[model samples]
Target chain A: MFTLLLVLLFIPFIGAFVTAPLQQRKADVAAVIMAGAVMLAAISAIIWAGGGRFDYSLAGLPWLTVPFPLFGIQVDPLSSLMLLAITVVGFLIVLYSAGYMSELNKEHPTQAEKDRYYFFTLLFVGAMTGLVLSRNFFQIFLFWELTTLCSWGLISHKRSSVAVQAGFKAMVITAGAGLFFIAALLIMYVKTGSFEFSALGQLPPTLRLTAVIFLLIGAWGKSAQLPFSSWLPTAMEAPTPASAYLHAAAMVKAGVYLTARTIISSQAVPAQAGYLMGGLAVATMFFGLILYFFQDDLKRLLAFSTIAHLGYMFLGMSLGVAGSRLALQGGLLHLINHAFTKTLLFLAVGAISCATGTRSIKALSGLGRKMPVTAAAFIIGALSISGVPPFNIFWSKFFIIAGAIQLNSAWGWTVGLLAIVESLAGFAWFLAVVHRVFFGPASPAAAAAADPPPVMLIPLLVLMVLSLLSPVFGLAIITRIMGG
Target chain B: MYLLNCLWLAFAILLAGSVLCLVSKRHKVNGPLAMISMAAAGLLAVFVAVQVWLNGPVTAGIDSLSIAGFPAVPVFTVDRLSALFLGLIGILSMASVLYTQGYLPHYKSEDPRRYYPPFLLFVLCMMAVVTVADLFYFLFFWEFMTLTSYFLVVYQRDNKKNLEAGFLYFFMTHVTSAGLILVTILFSGWTGSLSFTAIPEIYRQRPPPTRPC
Candidate 1:
């Protein structure tokens, strides 16, 4: 089982380096194969981990001054669930990327940069895997930086001036704020002499508050909350698959993972910290929703929606931190749910752009007539991401708001009402995007467009199915994480 | 003994390269000379740092370096924290020195001597700031680092914006250095010593701050 965990963690990294020098077509094949292997490995590791927590240290250097687990793997239900999202969704995206990054596609067609694309994409898979499995702050921080670097590489894949600037902006804001995480880690290490997550609970009250605040700041920057969120929209300049995988699915989730992990592992997190997190999260949520009305570019719209969805997760986690276990479960569940849903939306948009060579909402119309499969995929994804019922995100968002209402406090009720309003607003807006872009008379571009090749459509179909079934699976996993 | 030798070798190489660049007649060789010297020195510094990381703190310095009636202090020390900074400085120096090769060509009209010497000195000052064990000497090297970096920032003296940016950087950093120096002075006064090792004991004795939450 441990070997399976190791395989799940390292195979993508090894594949990433190996694929870097290969020819474009071969690299694409190798990437899909590698992602498939990782998916299988993740399933096995999850089954082995079950609902129980386990930690394994690769090296036993007892003499080392830095205490706690070193080069260690921690397996539990939360990590296992994240593993499923990253590897399974990652594999699908890689499959889609293989078909999308080719001469056959219409929008920005080029097979020339496939190697670089796959390299960073695979590296992100490995980094996200490592990040979720890390047992301690030290290890998580290392993988966190690796995820940032991989996203920077992918975001700037085209090397256009805008892409490069977006990449640097993302790097500077995230990594610079990450310095606070390091400061928190150092404070904890100085006090407890261990980097393990458990050490955070043992800190004296003042130090714990200071460290938690610092850690949350770092998470905010990574997750692109208020004052740090400008980078995410600009990041859409990346290749669509990279945009889907890195921006929409994996890397942004790492921030909420940190917050959720903190809330789960420690009971001593200050109420002030929880309130602070909830307040800002709600603020970022509305911020994202407000920006949505101004975007004509479909990908940028999805990007802002991602920002809002991330806020929901942060809000959920903050509720949990404020003493609502159900909210914590919801937050963690949202991590999985939103990953699948948003990735689907991003990829479906990518397919639209591929077929029509345009992503403008105004420019694209009546796509349903010409690309029915893609239109259906987009509608399903938009609904799910908007937290519509019976879909994946609805379940998580319901739990989060339910938990908020369960708190029975003014803060809880206010945040809950805000979340509900945001969801309604989001659904209405996305419904508009869908109706305008997919319904009515076919525009010239939509008349010419058709469903993408099977390579691309399969992933969308698979994700669409998952988006529908995710609630059941998400509940089971979240229940296990909560020891139910 | 081996760690000490590595440290000395690294410093000696950097110092020799700085001097060589200062006196070099040909501008073309200066870039390569600085690059090779910085690379070799960085590698050695990192090698010593690795040993320090694996084997705990290593003090590689003169045990006694009294000036007149001044209290004797160890010159250099490599602990886990210092070693980490040393490794970062090593990596950054290697990168910036290598970058100088391409960057220098753009500055072909300017005297190359002005650029390479200050750059090497900047790296050397940074290394010294991390390695010096005495708080007083750390401050000394810290100030030197700022000066050399300012010189590098304004290397193209003809650009007014560059000069203004350099001055802004120098002013802001020196103010920071003043705050650091004030804290260092307070610590030295309390501990009755200038060694970094002594300040920790004083810190441990102080009462913890009040909890905000």
Candidate 2:
């Protein structure tokens, strides 16, 4: 079973390598193959992690062994679930990109950069797979950095000066965090005589505290907590697929995963760490939601909302193990839900941008009449992200708020209240965006624009349906994985 | 023994390739050549790293290979952590290099060879810094990595913002390196050895000093 998990991680990388030499004309074919590989990998990972019987292994070469201890990879319950989330969402986004990018390519004929886009997209999926399945911190960090590099490429894909600047900012901020991460690992090695995560997990109290704090800094940067939150909004300069990838599915989730891993592994770390995490999470949530109210760009508003939602995940994970167990499960489940819902919204936005040639909220109006299907998908996604009932995000946010209230601490109560306030603020903002863009008098562009091609619209519909169905599957996974 | 040879070979190839690309007249081939050499080196490093990751840290030394009183230091130690970083470097460099194949055309009019190869070399140097176990080797690679990347960042010297970003990045990374090196030196002095493997046991037996440094 663990071996199946390991294989799942490498499948995308293999797919990427196989498709790399394919000509630019073969971009769609390559993308489909890559997406299919990811989907199969996701299915296998879910089944294996769901307690199904499966096992396989490739033996290490005997001659290369230097009599040193080697750490083999494992796919336990946690990794299997994460891999499943990454692949399912990643595959859908790739499918969505096929139609969305082609439309953009046609509109800007000189911008026929299909090869570069597909290559990096495949690379990103593969790297993300490696990140989730690796049992060792080293492997995780390797994949983590790969995701960073891949993201920089994606963010700068538009090649505009603004996009380039945003990419550079992201690189520096994340790379700076990477340095702190390296320092933490080095210190852990210096103290424990090993870099293996299992070894570090057994460390004494003081060492554990230091490692945990170091890990938190890395998470904070990657996840866009507090001071690091600015870059995520800037990342909206990327294409909608890239934005969805970074915000909902892969990159930001790395931070949540790191925090969860550290807290779970270091069981004896002081309660102070939890308190600190909770405080930061609460602060970031309110700050993000407050900022979201001021944004006029549709994507930027979503980006800020992403920050607020990330805060909920962080806060949930910080309330100690008992509190965090449910919180972390909720957080992870939210990540999966966000991937579908956000991608749906972004695809719809991309379609809207194509037809209207504008992203400004004020300039666009009454798109529902022209692009009815897209408008409906966008509404579904918007409602789900706002935590409306029966949607997957609502369930996860509910669990997080309930977890906070159960903590019975002043900070927890404050966080719970803030969660409600932030949700209301988010809902209000969404209503404003949707109402202004979809219901009011038709703008000049809306009157002339037609629906996007079915290639694009179908993916949006699939995602909308998935978003609606995700809650039931998510609840079952959470209960099984977390024993909630 | 083979690990030391492999480390030296990889470093020599990287140094030669970077220098060639920096000085070469034919700019068109420079990026590809540098990428190939790096890919070779990175692949070897990954092989060594995976071994370390799966088994344990591999340690080796070519003692007294240098004439100076200082011992001929170990050049490479593939511990589990280093292996992880090595894999990251391999994967990232591979993608960055491939992307550069398409991206360099945008900069071809401005000496593509000089712009791209140095960056690849810089990435290689960063990978080396993460894997080297000895303090001297670590610092050497660390400084080299910073210098190469600094040049790459400022490759667009005509742009004032580019130069400013480069300088800022240089200053920040140097400051970080200073802090890291200071800690390394303190650890070395405390343990009376530069080998990272020795420090953990030493620190375990003797609690760290009043202040970490």
Candidate 3:
């Protein structure tokens, strides 16, 4: 087990170093090796499972024990499932990048330029994986920070002054919010003495409240919820590939992951925290809806939508605290489901932009004929985000609502009503956009547009299939766990 | 355990394939080679996931791989939930890798060579993140994941905006790290142990300290 951990944990770092000096041609070799290693490690871990959940930690690494005993590998039902999302969805993005990124780099980069891209991209993937698998807050924090850095890098990849500013804003807000997380952890340490998640319950009520608030603030910044949401839309300055992989799928999810992880690690978190979370989620959703409908840029529109969906996940989490386990389950399922949906949408945009060299919604029209697959994928993605049934997002949203109602608190139901209203509004907006982008006569951009390459199309098809099938799979896992 | 070994063997095959792809990336055949290996790995992943789902959780430890020659008991298990995840991962990976085959050819203006390596590793890191149970290894993978993706983001680095975003992202990530570190310190106190297994037991035994909100 320890051997597997080491291989899985360190391959990317090795790949990064090896690929650093290599030119674009050679770096491809290193990337394949590293990815293969990670895939193998993931499969090996799955194979070790033989069909159930397990938790084991490889401990005793000296450097791993910093101020605390932090180095250890642990995986259970949740993390492993998350692994599926991370690796699988992540792979598709990488694959997409091969086509998408290379196409964008019309100027043949120097060997060093190519090397740097591979290095940081590999590191980002590794960091996100590590963050999810983390067993304790100390380790989680480490991975969490890495993800933030990766987000900044990915966001600013285009290095447009606008992109740089957005990335900077994102970093400042999230990192600043991170101060609260630091403060929370410090309080936890002061009250307790260890870095294990189990001791979270020991903090005095005041301290616990303080920590919870701090943690939420930190998560809000990272996840782009509420007041911090402005950066997410602006981050659309990044390439669509980066937006899909980093913002919509992985990095932003770090905050969601943190929120969920906190609830799991700490027992008996005060209900007030849950209520506060509920309030913020609701506000974020409303904020997202307001922003989502007004976007002229396709990616920015999707970005707002992502912020809204994130709000949904947070809501489910908050409800889990004050209301129902179903809420938590729904929230997590939504998180996973959103990964597929959001990535597809972003990729679809990439295809359209690739075809027409434009990202404006107003500029794109009647693309359905030329880029049928991408248009169809975009429609599905929109519907899923809007909560259409048979699609995965519908079910998760349903569960979140059900969970909220189950709380039986008037406040809970009120929140549920607001969410429903927002969801409905968002749904209508997506439908409208779909009609505008895919149904109308071809705009000038669409006239020249063509379907994306098979590489991009295939991933879209797969995502569509998964989006359709996810509810069944997600529900099965949930029922199994809830049943036992 | 035999199944587990099979899983590892399959992964090793994948690794070999990656090496091959790396060596041959300059050649036209690298695409097919990548697909074949990724497919094989994906199939194995599905196989493992299916077996685990049907059989229940698989838990074991190989202390022989311990660090510092002072064996720290390490366990990694995959249960129904994990298996479910593995299956999803396998399906997605296969689909995406196949997609890459067609996608890479569009880069008539630029070389697609550098994109593949980080792309693959990024996927791999995400997979590792979810399956591992240890806090330390998890963090290691997580950080690596970030670093790799960061590069992907900045692939168009000359644009300048990407650079600014990189800095902000770095700052945010550090703050989160700081917060997380503090939280971990608190948790370690209750159990006096770092193993994740120590957590629930503590939660079960001790109620959270009450505080007036």
lDDT of each: 0.83, 0.70, 0.71
lDDT of 1 by residue, B1-213 (tens): 778778878888988998899766466888889888999999998998888999988775575443211232647888899899999989988998887788778876466776787787788878888888887667667766876776688666545577567656765675565455445545554675778778779869999999999
Provide fnat values for all models in the order shown: 0.00, 0.00, 0.00
Top lDDT: which candidate number?
1
Across residues B97-200, which tens digit of lDDT does each residue of candidate 2 receive?
77877776776435565466667668767777877777745765675676577668756544557656765675566546545544544554456466767668
- Judge candidate 2 against the unseen true structure and give its global Cα lDDT, from 0 to 1: 0.70
Q: Give per-residue CA lDDT, model 3, range B1-213, as digits (tens).
A: 765665565556666765576665353777777778778877887898889878777765555533221112344566777678877877898898888788767755323434555555565556555565554344445655654565465444333475456545533553354343333333444544445566687779987989999
* Candidates, ranked, lDDT: 1, 3, 2
Candidate 3 regions off by >4 Å? A25-33, A50-68, A104-112, A479-483, B1-213
Tell me the tens digit of each residue's lDDT in model 1 across A226-331: 8789989999989998999875558888888888788777666899898998999999999999999999999999999989989999998889878877677778
Docking quality of model 1: it rates as: incorrect
Which stretches of candidate 2 lie above 4 Å from their native place?
A1-7, A21-25, A52-71, A103-111, A265-269, A320-324, B1-213
The residue-level lDDT of candidate 1 at A389 comes to 42
Candidate 1 has a DockQ of 0.01
Q: Give the TM-score of candidate 1.
A: 0.69
lDDT comparing candidate 3 with the true structure: 0.71
DockQ of every candidate: 0.01, 0.01, 0.02
Winning candidate number (TM-score):
1
Estimated TM-score per prediction? 0.69, 0.66, 0.67
